[model samples]
Target: MEVKGRVSNSTGTIVQSEDEIDLRRGPWTVDEDLALINYIANHGEGRWNSLARSAGLKRTGKSCRLRWLNYLRPDVRRGNITLEEQLLILELHGRWGNRWSKIAQYLPGRTDNEIKNYWRTRVQKHAKQLKCDVNSKQFKDAMRYLWMPRLVERIQAAAATATAGSPTASASATTTITNNNNTTYNYNNNLNNSFEVHSGNMMLSPAIMNNNFGGSQSYTPENSSTGASSDSFGTQVSPVSELTQDYYNNVTVVNSNNNNNPNPDYYPQVQDQLSFLDCITSPSGLFSQQLDFQSMEPNTPWIQSNGDTYNGFWNVENMLLFQQLTDNM
Candidate 1:
């Protein structure tokens, strides 16, 4: 249909085109979807306005773009979001608030719209139920301290279970990290023995238990038979522990010997318990630690539940802990 001049139709609202063709909306039909897919496959994507017309699709350019990017694309991943992904979404949202496209870059296969919807439906709902603003420090602290740790615990549990039948395979889940000082540390994932992901250099070890937030205590898995010895940092590394140590050693090195002559005393006790506590409490410092973006699964959808049963997250124990934490906050 071609635009002739301004005219009013059933609604008596004057529109730009006199003989305007009614554009299709709502869910796309199978034929329309196939046409779009075939057109793109033959000619490639971009120039959405002309592509829509050329492809004989009555949908608007923006609509077609959204549909392709969010749904019909070959690489669009679909399924239930895994625990690892949930942790990542929370972490990324904290960093780049409302910048969905930027956050989507880190989480491969996930569309920005999906992430935004998940935040609104799941995260914001929980915040509303708690009777606090989603951006409030109290709620953020609850997520950082309580919810996020719970997610990490779930991810570890899932990973452990996934590799359970293959102890040999799990043990092979190791990463070699090189600090800025040119010191290389080989990390292993010997989850059976201990939760301590020791750096080969014995630099810093962080605990990965439910309540051990930044505590230096060593943890051994149930019925494990091994123990740490000299040069014992050869176990498999959990994502968080590995990322934390790598970030500290490579990104934020504090050397007392540097003659740059400033407040070198800033983090005097970098390797002490207090520093670990600081890492835990400081939201900017804690979640900003880079994750293994490659390990993230395809676009998966996850939702958090209300009180009494939040995907096994909000038990009496966690509720009490959250209260105690918020009170402190």
Candidate 2:
């Protein structure tokens, strides 16, 4: 039987180098594996040209070795590694460094590629958590506990400029301008006090200020008018009362919805019990009727009740859940 297979090597007229040879390309089957293994066993695994000739196999030595190690090796564990393997890779890389191939050797099923990917992902995740850009100066400062003093001065100058234009700038505008002129003195004083309080352990980097205070905070009129003025220091200041009132009103609406149901148990345990009482009392007292029905006939009403009861129950539950979530906010 003249069974023909794809020719492993092109029979070229020119005797060219190995690089010039075109090996056969196809999926390896059990027959191919057996032939390759037998060839390796007989030849003792060296000299690709001689092995290919003697074994009647078409693959190069490098290809043969890759196939054997990746697929046929007895110790090569298959399938994906678990979360435990991922953590091990992180810890090992942190301690021993980025020797991925070496790390893969320890992880029976893990590939070097997998380890490298995991490391890259973990680094990105940590960088995000720290609120520092991996490519920015803040990230470098975080990694090395040091920052350019000139950069700090630039940040201070920017802060002074922002303070001058702030709403509070009207009240202590003169003091603020004077402070801006004498920023070096005030900065030194503040830095000294902060250093004393933290015992030099907590160095307030520009990164921390940028991350925490760069965004909006509770704006007090005294602070707003005294923009960058030391005179407002130690003064009683509350965030804009209007903002707080609006927040509370929104909370009240959510709370009202939560307590409208007859079934108080549906509401969150942390919900203000007093607000739940008010909700049940308000809105034409519908929940009162539901409460009466629930108490008088439990199992009988459960079957006979229309869709109204269920809808009201769920609506109230949803409102209560929203309130519970908002209360923390």
Candidate 3:
């Protein structure tokens, strides 16, 4: 099955004949995708260089590998990133920074490239709007105190909505949670791990968090100063079922400039307005050590309003607050 071509050796021996392979480039065609898929399906993966040659694909090993992993793989999840995923990404990035591959490992079906793209396109876009370095203390604090908490709230709200939408599904999930000895339920099957429910509080397995999140020790309620079930973030947190309707109805942004008047428009509608960042300073040791909440101005313009179209990450409150603050500056 070998294709032979002219060959010569310095020793005047034509021991073997080989031809230089003309590797294909650019976007892969359907035929190439099918070829790669079929080859991998039959022979399994690995040995990419030889696999490419054996499969008769004109593409290079690296290109084939990227295509398979990023797109053609059977279990590769697609479409928009979910609220749960967004939360996990923020948590993981907070822990690991730009270790995209490491972060991708925890997020099932998500490729490192996809995660990197999301960070660059969505997360960093918001960071740029904030007019601060992504790595800066102010930005990180804004993420931890404002952005991450809003994500948690949205996750809780979404879970609540899903439960309310289907009584049968909710009942089944409840039954599964109750019967399981480990007290873990993976509501989002797209994720690699399970969510632990204990006394109506959603608990992430310290093992899952520590192992995939690049830590050795488990994060527990005991770790939180507030003595509530907490994630790695050290904030007092709870599950969806435990949070009351008032919790959903009440998210306020106080105007630091105008006698701390509560912004009436700040109530986040779970379906639309779920993401925002405020200038509120955090005392949590989870943020940077050098960050002094006392020294910073009350109405710092953390964001610039360019009238970007509203994505799930940016909402009216964020823009309004930013615009107001920008005016003051």
Tens-place lDDT digits, model 3, residues 253-306: 112343221221211122321111111233333333444333444332222343
Question: Which digits, one per residue and each the tens of the lDDT, describe model 2 over residues 1-329?
Answer: 12223334466444545542455445555555666655554445657556665666566666666565555432233333332243344334543567887666445434576667765675445446545554454443322221112222233333445445545323211221122223212112222122122211111222222233342422322232122322222221112211222222332212233222211221223221122122234444323322321122111121113322212222343334334433444
Task: Looking at model 3, report the run of 10 residues with the lowest lDDT sum.
Answer: 191-200
* Better candidate number, 2 or 3, judged by lDDT: 3
Cα lDDT listed for each candidate: 0.50, 0.36, 0.47
Model 3: per-residue Cα lDDT at residue 242: 14
Candidate 1, poorest ten consecutive residues by summed lDDT? 222-231
What C-alpha RMSD separates each model from the true structure?
16.8, 31.2, 17.9
Best by TM-score: 1
Residues 1-329, model 1: lDDT tens digits: 32234567789987765123667778777677767766776677889988998999877788789887877653333444434446667766786688887666544445788888878888898788778899988888767766776655444443344334223323334456555555565433222111221211111121232223322223332111111111122243323333334443444323234332112221122232222233344554544453322243312212243211144455456566668878775
lDDT of 3 at 214: 37
Q: How many residue pairs clash in each candidate?
A: 7, 4, 0
- Indicate the residue-level lDDT of 182 in model 1: 57
Q: Could you tell me which residue pairs clash in candidate 2?
A: 168-224, 168-225, 168-226, 258-320
In Å, residue 318's CA in model 2 sits off its true spot by: 26
Ranking by TM-score: 1, 3, 2
